[model samples]
Target: MTIRISRRRLLTTAAATSIGVLAMPYLSRAADRPQITHGVQSGDVGADGGVVWARADRPSHMMVEVATTESFSHAKVLPPIAALPESDFTAKMLLENLPAGQETFYRVRFRDLAHPAISSEPAIGRFRTAPADRRDVSFVWGGDVAGQGWGINPDDGGMVTFATMRRHRPDFLLHSGDTIYADGVIAAEVKLADGKVWKNVTIPEKAKVAETLDEFRAAHKYNFLDDNVRAFNAEVPIFVQWDDHEVTNNWSASKQLPAAYKERSIGLLAARSARAFHEMYPMRESLAEPGRIYRTLHYGPHLDVFMLDERSYRGANGENQQTAYGPESYFLGPDQLAWLKRGLLNSRATWKVIASDMPLSIIVYDDAANRSGSEAFAQGDGPPRGRELEIADILRFIKSAGIVNTVWLTADVHYAAAHYYNPDKAQFQDFEPFWEFVAGPLHAGTFGPNQLDNTFGPEVKFIKAPGQGQQNLPPSAGMQFFGHVRIEGATGQMTVTLRDRADVALWSTTLDPRPGKPG
Candidate 1:
């Protein structure tokens, strides 16, 4: 419950002060006596700046610093930063005015002022700046890496997925949701006498919190403890947002959770979770503001990425007719809907990618009693709220506005699948062709086993579940994999490739947005 740094290693009051203020004696070198337990982490990279972070194994509060160069040998280390008692012993430092489309290295050392406190060997990694002009760029993003368990094979799951993505060398990583399973429950693997099996169980300790602030903090630390998860983070710059699991599954804005929020005294559960989310992820100010996680990033004029917040503005589940299936009745709230509409309408990019935590489309088994699957299990009242955003209306809006170059990238369905949405539902409206691509579980287990058939084995359209050809693990609905989206800004062409941890390209597809025409 507490994080402490020992003062025994204090630099001679005058010795450490000289590090940046003045030249200190050649106290020590990182390689000579390294004390870092985890590797380095960098995030929030923009044309102007980014964050450099790391943790130490020894007890010490030292200053954290960074340099624009991959080797700190000739770079400047900023002021010494002491670790706050609240965050255990982790240190996150901001580096400003970093060069674009380049690499940076950072170091962490403790104070005792007497020595360098055996700094951790610095980590060097590369990142790309938002294209300043129309040029090609590529990136990857997906979320909900809850822990692994059940009959799952660790070697063949999330860890493998991270290895797959590492091969792509994306500019940044966008984590959509459920970065950690805060509820902390797993399947019981046994059938209850009442004929109800506990497919998911919420841990009692995490459930007993009076305020969600501490609860969410606990969840973050749990995620950082995973080795494979930490490695994926070390390699890429991460832009993140919260989904249901970070707090509670399927939480809509202001929607109450009787078992959890009902006991909280301070701020709403959503607010508490949001704070914890930002504190843990090195996300920039764009998504840091409350109720405004929606924002647009333009990779030159080649691609315009719109990250949306669907659950917050969503209408409660159930059969309540009257309004058109969009905007006013959108899964995206008022502010977000408007922003998205304007962003889409104004985009001149070759490709428009909408990053959403929930699938724009997924199976919604109506009828509450017979309902199953993850989303249904997390809904409120009536038959499962199957596709409430009025899939029809949203698609129409995209077409009507001439937002021709658009594609949706999403996770959370637990299974990786690709499909095109027809504004014209095949059953009714003429199908308007818009495509969607999905990937998953960076360092979390493959989707919790499917209820009836235990379908981790891929029978659907997708590639081999990583290593399955060489070693093999159960196939997954969304086989633990990461998404690699490569776009040629010049040609307005996009190529998507999915890879397993073994660096094998599993599945891929291409899309071409020719001015205002469909691909």
Candidate 2:
């Protein structure tokens, strides 16, 4: 039950040293040795296994060693895997047969392919495996990093919200989409609304919109340049999903080529972005459906997170007002919706958390300037139309199957709020009452308190956003937010709290699990 981390490997040193730098190869003590660039990360952890990821500066072999102690006494060395040019020098390997409910420490180093004797300095990472039995569980959820031209600003503390979240020391982070803003360019400096200068640490790859495969890869890598993000990744595992920004803003099958993009084919850009997304994160691969983002992660007896991908399969974005189940109504798509229902029915956990990338009732515009076209599920406030049909179906299915304790957590609209969906007040009232919590803009522009649609009758309980006539406010405005959730083992009650970058709780509510639901 005792776990510890070395002083040098912990967060303080990482925070003080690695700010806004790419951990480039040439900066290494020995230029010929392969460097462990971008540090290390762990993800998709469960009772028995997890995925370990790291990137190297050159073609090398990634070697990993696992241990239960900080001193690495009796550490077990795993087989080495090759990191080649095909994957952009990034590699991840599944670590199996880990003990449940215990802290696991792993060390990663890259050995030069040309000279096996030469190896880079080891990067350390730690994560606690999911409990085999009922126990207290806690985690953080948020997303939207480096979005809306807000890149790493070292002068402004280099994405300090990540450091704030890391202080909580959650078991993992449920990153609800917008992992990177591939379409958003990052300049060296930006002029804020207050006439103050916001300095950014920019690279050539992030200077323009991502078009080529390498550009997409670089976009993902750009986030790691922030020391806070890298330190957070080393300590906590991440369960990640992608939304529109991973490819482009409001991207769909019918997206028009923008003036900034030289590569006209949206399909090609999407393909490259998907490849880079899979390469960058430490998510488990789906053999059945390769590059699939939607999957279930069983954290323990108390929690099961259902990660959804709302971007990959969908119709074109427009005025989403379809009245029936069709291409335009496909939000989760048919396959993913079925998988979610099946997973919910099969789950035995106390809390069934639907980790959606987009909120249900918040009206996100595909064309924000014109304020027309639906980017999310809510198409005005009337009935369950367009993409809302798919969500309504899922909600109805959850109710009919008597699945209790179902909650939705999302982070796409760049703000934080709480909504209570009541069937009695709804236009479509088949679903049972539930709670949907929203939080985000982990380190991006803060813009909402968006208009809510009453299709499923969502009543806003609380909201925090920019003032009227204000939008895309910088993180320096102190509006950045994230959600923290904890489930008590003995009581089976889940508490959700919305907090800002300063780690101050803005609002919170505790929900008791439904009766007769197995804990």
Error of 2 at 226 (Å): 0.7
Worst 10 residues of 1 by lDDT: 450-459
Error of 2 at 365 (Å): 1.6
Tell me the tens digit of each residue's lDDT in model 2 across 1-519.
001223233322232233211132432467767888898999999887689899999988887777789887556666578899999999898876677898989989898888776788889999999998888999999989999999999889999999999999999999999999999999988998789999999999998899999999999889999999999999999999999999999998889978999999999999999999999999988979989999999999999999999988888898878887898768889999999999999999889999999999998998888998888888998888899899889999998888999999999999999999999999999999999999999999999778888899999998999888899999898899999999998998999999999999999999999964452
Best by TM-score: 2
lDDT at position 519, candidate 1: 23
Clash tally for model 2: 0
The Cα RMSD in angstroms, rounded to one decimal, for candidate 1 relative to the true structure is 8.5
Per-residue lDDT over 1-519 for candidate 1, one digit per residue giving the tens place of the 0 to 100 score: 111222232211333443643343333554544345445666766654566665554444545444445555444445565544455445666555544454555555554322453444444444455655656677887776644332223433434455556656777787777777755444434243346432432333344432556677656755554455567677777766666666665554434455644654223666676666665666544435544567776555677777776655565544333234443344665566677788888887778888877764344333325663224212222221334434444555876766676887777655456665443334324224666766765645554222211101112345233332321122333355667888875676888876554555678888886577442
**How many residue pairs clash in all the candidates, one count each?**
21, 0
CA lDDT of every candidate: 0.55, 0.88
